[model samples]
Target: MTTARRIPVAIVGGFLGSGKTSLLRRVLTGAADTAVIVNEFGEVGLDHQLLRACEERVELLGGGCACCTRRADLVRTLRDLLDDRDRGRAELRRVVIETSGLADPAPIAFTITSDPMVRHHFEVERLIVTVDACNGPAQLAAHPEVAKQALLADELVITKVDLVEPEARDRLAAQLSELNPAATIRTAVHGVLEHEALRASAGRAEPGARPDGRAPPPPARAGAGGHTDDVRTLCMDLDRPIDWLGFAVWLSMLLHARGEEVLRVKGLLELEDGTLVSVNGVQHVMHTPEHLPRAAIADPRPGIVFITRGLDVHRLRDSLETFQRLARAGAGVSGR
Candidate 1:
């Protein structure tokens, strides 16, 4: 008989100096026998060696983020870990991947969720991101990749808050709220949080819990730009319901044309025909369109969040609406 699958496979990601390692150290100290995959960008993985106690089970795949140059290596390493558990050499309970600070979380996440073998043994419990409170704002202003990390996280953790002034803290919180209003923001000092709340999500919805706790409330209004330490995130909310077929067509074209730059697209769309679709995409690949089992009719306004590198929001909005309008016009004629 096959053993039951486990939960609590978390991804601890953040920009450089965002306290990712510090958080992992805390988790490992408490959760024993947990499997960890560490990816480092430097030639020498000194950080991996630093975690002395976890040496035996910890696997290091240093070189770059697994999604870019070392994707195959990542797949192979995970395969080996699965094999070990089957052979009874190690009893693995949970898995955590600490991504490089500059890495794009979407591709790494897509691999885990899309791969057949890995999906069977592991499920993505949640993505936890650490924000360097002192410098997060400046970083987002300069680096686009950092913005991607903030947007993709399920939970946003503000690290090194003690280092910054209270004024800076307020600004950082406001900026983070704008960038990833979707994720729950928690402050951490020396990397400590209540385990139940920190890891409460555990890759499963407890009884009627919704993922990410309902759709991110829409941005107050259309914004020109929002900046973090290194990148920017643009949010747009449609005042009226959207035409589903047209939205699909526009999304397909957008992905085909700018997939690499498009890190992630997640939104709740109200269809013209009265059904609702929760659509999410990572780079060029998109998850099969997921229809909500029930309608969120109370909130009919469609909301869209896009994480991209160096894309003009105004231009994108124009193109998307144009495609949507064309699609709807065609549908109207067909109905007659």
Candidate 2:
């Protein structure tokens, strides 16, 4: 029997009035093979209504926010999407999870990776975030959620650029870069982005390409330019394998304790057993770590890049190192 192809999930998120709906509309304008699962906080899902394709299976999640309180609902909806596809109810080329304006991409993404039922069926293909040029700067400055949205983005599309002045646009672009140096930034008009840009933004990796969910770690960078002026990005390179169990426990605990401030965590860790592990998270939701091919794998340099709010990277690195050491010592005891 042929193995079923796993569907890719593209998560679209942004702050309130950030043009998320408009950009989603553009993606579905002519793509008949695509399907969507939209989480609308209101009783009525206007985004689903706007999608005119009769064949497109658009599931609307309303009442509470999908990324937080209603996150379990999202997992159920995704399973349903896969079931429908398996039963020939829908033919889809791609699936997009359009989050509510107030949503964070983390929890939903965590649901996708963390759940057993849908984990193998769906891989997070991309996280696209829209920033309204007119209000993006102010939103980034005044709202922590806005920064979180941007920090979690794989592609940051600045919409309504025509409404803002050139200088303002540049400033916003720079700020976004500071927030997520790894994300590709683009300007959009009327929520329309270039097809090439969209394709690039998705990274469009084949199933095995990014098995670990680690996008190329952003270059080593350190800055405090965004609002709160506390979001610190720390990048590191490690040449040794680590103790996976201990590191996982420690990192998980760290997120539990300081999830609000630990915006984005991307790391490529080498295990003591000579395996390469990719570990990353957004806020409190850690993506399931993946083990890569061990024999002469490409891009073997283990890198950790973080975009955080008031996190002490030095302390974090030291703690991680300590955990790995203890884990190794325990493992040796077990072997004896």
Residue 193's lDDT within candidate 1 is 52
Q: Which run of 10 residues does model 2 get worst, by summed lDDT? A: 199-208
- In candidate 1, stretches whose alpha carbon ends up further than 4 angstroms from where it belongs are 1-9, 26-34, 40-70, 87-94, 113-126, 138-148, 163-165, 179-183, 194-233, 239-243, 272-275, 285-290, 295-301, 329-336
Per-model TM values vs. the true structure: 0.68, 0.72
Candidate-wise lDDT, in order: 0.62, 0.67
Candidate 2 lDDT for residue 145: 71
In terms of TM-score, the best-performing candidate is 2
Flag regions of model 2 displaced more than 4 Å: 1-5, 40-68, 113-115, 162-167, 192-227, 272-275, 292-300, 327-336
> Which candidate should be chosen as best, given lDDT against the real structure?
2
